[model samples]
Target: MSFIRQNSKLVDEFWEKGIVESCPIYDMHGHMGEHYAIYFAAPNADEMVTLMRRANVAKLCFSHHFSLWATPHVGQAPALEAARKYPDILRFYCSINPHYPDQIKQDLAKVGEWIPYCVGLKFLPDYHKIPVSDPAYKPALDFAEALHLPILIHTWNGSPYDGPAVLRDVVPHYPHVTFMCAHCFNNNWTAAGELAKDYPNVYIELTSVPGTRGAIEKMVSICGSEKILYGTDMPWFDEHQGIGGVLAADISDDDIHNILHRNAEKILAPFL
Candidate 1:
């Protein structure tokens, strides 16, 4: 066998299989339904949905800066609108910037009204500037628990200023909150896998880690595919590239099912 076949065997297989390559994979973590700054630009919402539809993305988790980290409060209402317009393609998640004046509660209320439209909640602690475990926003936590909505959050790794808050503290406090830690706690992939091993509610996304060596091996070992989710982090990253990296991991067919799609379906199926 050639080196390319040996290393990217799974990648090739998945590509050949196309959308049917894995279980009903829903992108559990992604952000697009926002006004883009020069620094960050992605295909507009329609284009995004189109891409997702082509990729057979059954569900999408989106956050809006208006209600999230933006000033003057932009409600994720537009995100919900997109979800409504493309019910099969989107699952809106209300966002909270605890730093914003009354945003914590306000976003929660918007989430409540988003009923019949959206599915869960998203937090950008690195960009929003909120302590993950802060009791100040217990309302949001409580709502997630009550609504049985999973909370997906961004975490830091090598990037010095990605997500300022540590997810470790928050996971312990909200045991019932199904938390999807983005970046797989880059600096803490092992820890993330341990959390998944330890807690049923905790899950991890393979957004960039597979691009590295150690993280991929550690993830396969610790999380064992079932608790892992596949997402590219999109525009900032590449879906096919991320998928290629994951397929390159030393894992099995069953493992591929969980990482690429099964786990995501399990997590978001309730809302979908």
Candidate 2:
């Protein structure tokens, strides 16, 4: 066989046949929702698991589409059902809306009821047009602190509500709660890395960031391998790129192991 055909055969024998296994891999950030129209459609829950399994991800923790696109409760129903069907492979974050304080209370109650199934909480302040610094959002932050659950916030630069600076005010208040700077604060990775260094409770989730090896290496250098995690904003982006970026980074094997799964094991220990 030609070299390309030989390589293709090897790939099929290993990855396709599920014989290639690395250290336990976990996808720390992802979403499943039907509302995502043609341009945004992520796979349904079943297809998501199949995708993860093919990629050798042992566990996946995500939030609902309804929570992000429709309403928190509507988004949660499918997540709950998926958890029931794929309890071993799936975990979820409780979506809490700061705009509706009453609904926030209600969701916290649901989170409490869900127990191990609800591993953490996700906040999309920008999507809801609320700032994390707003006092109205305190209850959700407080609930997460009380339970020691991690909070994954959608962050970006130049946004008054979701910017990295908001954490300066919020992280100090909930020292016990672990805060995942989702997407590495998107366009504001530098500031996000600084926050991770400043706050021991803060962490970096690598989703939707630039896929360059240098970018990944820089993040590892800034945040330390222990605070960095592997997350693909799946259904929107390709997991192969996310996985390949980390693999191609000029980091030690131990660091790769930590980012791929060990750090998540430590952060989500309560649930795992």
Candidate 3:
């Protein structure tokens, strides 16, 4: 069966319930919202569910885009409200930007109150013009360390987009906190491999890296299936393109299962 229909299929097909129950895909690191201009066209809460139902995605983790993460100064009450509005279908991660050092504590506090409901945190350091280990945002690193919440951080590997070197600073402090580094760390994958080896909680997502040769296999070799999870980073990566990328990786079926669904199933289990 086709894993996804076009975004319009959710509205056009009028087969939401059947569609949802029919398929078993679950997108762990995808985002949808109208508030951000980067993903201004991304689905809103309702639209997102319709698409999930259409794609037969059993659950979808709403990883809010880098825009909000970059602008941590903004109030997150509205985003929390939106998550509450779609409780059964949505799960939230508090996105942070360390540049707004004054606001980091307040944001973490608010997120703490929302937890067990809000189970994770996300970071887009590149967009915020910082790296994962930047000293200025040490409060966030420390809080995640203490709280033990999983953080889905953005890391790119190449030009046009840059990322942290070894994630050395944060990894040591937050040994218990789960860090799901997104985008396979772009082209700086060697650093990605090394960090995964060094930090057990440093999980990596096999999102847009499917087309690259041996990328998924290399990550699996270094980080293992359990540490690698399925992700689409959708709209930026199409459903067909994203899923195909993972399948192309020459890994075992079981490992693919972990990346595609099981890892996410495990990650969001507490909140679920």
Candidate 4:
């Protein structure tokens, strides 16, 4: 038997049954609603919850595509309704678009109304065409810091907006807020590892990282398991694919456990 199958019950259980009951997944990054540019197989709440059940996912924290792609008013409604309807399986991040300063202020003012369901804030700086460190994000960052909420930022390897360099400027300022670097600064593994090592409140999220062989193992080695989070970017990628990638990585079962759910649990404790 392989070392993983021998030492990790989760591996055997997942291999045989396709889901591990003992270690249910907590997908920290996800999206609801169809994208204007691309098609998604499971965009609606019902279909997503069904997939979550099949994958033994305990909870999924998501932002609506409309919120990111369309106006916040048009996008936040579906996310709110979905979380309201499926409280146990879903939580949402309030998407912030820096372009609409008035809307940003309006939304942040009403944040309390979305409480319990809106666990944190989501920033798509690359798409929004603004650097995360810009003053435009100040209100959202301030609110997140005050509430001690996690902020999921869509980071890429070389984007001027939400890349590692931009993150370096912003993460240090908000020491109280948890910054989940979605996609782990894609392809920039060294910088991602360094960010997690340097900032106690910063976490590297595994959205697109798993697709790169040896990335997860390298991250664990550099920053340890506690600073890494498991996120599928679901509807865009399947949960099983992400889970399989982590399971196949040459890391301890304990490391797998931390990436899959334990670390996420700790991040969500204050909100949920």
Candidate 5:
């Protein structure tokens, strides 16, 4: 770690000041309310904001857990309310549960009303038990493509629902939408890297990525820093730990900056 500090000024600054003012963090993947299966010490908007302030997080674009797991009618309110309450530091992704096509249609129709606060759409195909290429997600996909929205999809190594093969079929179709491969397709780095490299609009999101040693460095080597986006499943994961992992990686300060905020800022510019 000392070698990392010696080579990277950002790392040294973070070590000395707890947070680097020069490199503000923009968390692209996060969640709001508590999950039914897990316990969170700071799951609410207020608690999350407090944590963000301490970590020098510039913004956190999140989709509430309720919005992802529960029915749209019951889940969307919390995300919308949180974003409305903290417009400056917070933004939300409209979660689409493909399980209910009617709900998906209804939610996609109202997406415009949640604008500025709503940055894009989120899909948990793995949980929804539907492939990303399924017709059930077409309405939301069309909306995102039309608006050039960023869609964060929960991808895993070999998940039939949202795996690399399924994503390949879907990514090229919606060229306008920014596809954020959350968790970097989990353990399948090759597929994740290939997706980022093959598709200009596709990016590798570092949510659970940092936990695997050399993952960040490897991703940078594979797709370059510009194709990598910083993300932490906040409340579900520690913000400081996520940021620190990037700062401590065997990569340059410029790469760290890109992952932490630069790339995210570029992608979010149109919406903001």
Candidate 6:
């Protein structure tokens, strides 16, 4: 208890001395639009912007909640509007419905028009209940690869829909498309680490992932911080948890900078 309390104080001091300001922090995974749950902050772009600004976030990459919950077109509106309003600090991802082949085609056709404005595509096979290897996903994946847009895939190890094992098959095939695995494959950091270790194009986003002692360190050791990105799954999860996890990790300042922002700059290079 004493050690835990003492470490907590040091973490507070780390931010008090302005250590987080050393580099621009970019939130690589977030959501915009209303979530019916009362526990979440009201879904509005202005509120989202305010939350990021308070956290010292220089930029945020997010998708619309509607897209993940309902359909692609319905969700893209809010996300696109927010990106247009705050082009400097906000960029969005286009979602596709694998069950609807025409929707996927329409979404991909319009994706080219959102370039520089839309940074990537967000795939939540877990929500859609589809496999990453589905035939419908290939066209969109191909389009993203051709344009060099990063593809953020929600991965939860052991799940039938999308998980590390699913990623293992899909990632290798799309070598040109940067696969940002959300949640570090969730509770399966070992598998996530191995995936990143093996694939140069594979990246990891630390959102709802466990921030236990030596977890971040192990990821850094395996991936070298070049492929690790900081994300807050915001409004649903607190940004401080993600930010403080990396800040308080037992790594060098350079590694901290890379995870906080440098790596995102590289990941989003095509859009920027």
lDDT of the candidates, in the order given: 0.67, 0.76, 0.66, 0.88, 0.89, 0.79
Clashes of each: 4, 2, 7, 0, 0, 0
On lDDT, the stronger of 2 and 3 is 2
Instruction: Please write out the lDDT profile of model 4 over residues 20-110, one tens digit for every residue.
Output: 8778899999998888778888989999999989999988999998877776458478788999999998999989989987777877777
The sequence of per-residue lDDT tens digits that candidate 3 reaches over residues 1-272 is: 32322333322232334332322566667665544445534456676666555556665665555336545544455457667877766666777766676666777877767875577777777777766666766777777788787888777865222354546655776787888888778765666777777787877776677678878788788767787777776545555456556655667766766776777777777777
Error of 3 at 221 (Å): 2.7
Residue 161, candidate 3: Cα error in Å is 10
TM-score of each: 0.85, 0.89, 0.80, 0.96, 0.97, 0.90
Per-residue lDDT for 1-272 in model 1, tens only? 53322654555655765455445456666666444563444544687776666566666666654556563445666667677887776777777666654766666776766765677777776675556666655678788888778887776764332332355555677766888878887767777788778778888877767668667668779867788887765545555566667666677767877787788877776665
lDDT of model 2 at residue 251?
73
* lDDT head-to-head 5 vs 6, winner: 5
Model 3 spans with C-alpha error above 4 angstroms? 1-23, 35-41, 65-74, 158-164
> Candidate 5, TM-score vs. the true structure?
0.97
Better of 2 and 4 by TM-score: 4
Overall local distance difference test of candidate 5: 0.89
Candidate 2 Cα errors over 4 Å, as ranges: 1-20, 37-42, 72-75
Question: Considering lDDT, which of the candidate structures 2 and 5 is the better prediction for this target?
Answer: 5
Clashes of 5: 0
Residue runs of model 4 more than 4 Å from their true location after superposition: 1-7, 72-75
* Candidate structures ordered by TM-score, highest first: 5, 4, 6, 2, 1, 3
C-alpha lDDT of residue 49 in model 3: 66
The better-scoring model by lDDT among 1 and 5 is: 5
Please list all clashing residue pairs in model 2, or write none if there are none: 66-75, 67-75
Candidate 6: residue pairs that collide: none
lDDT of 4 at 271: 64
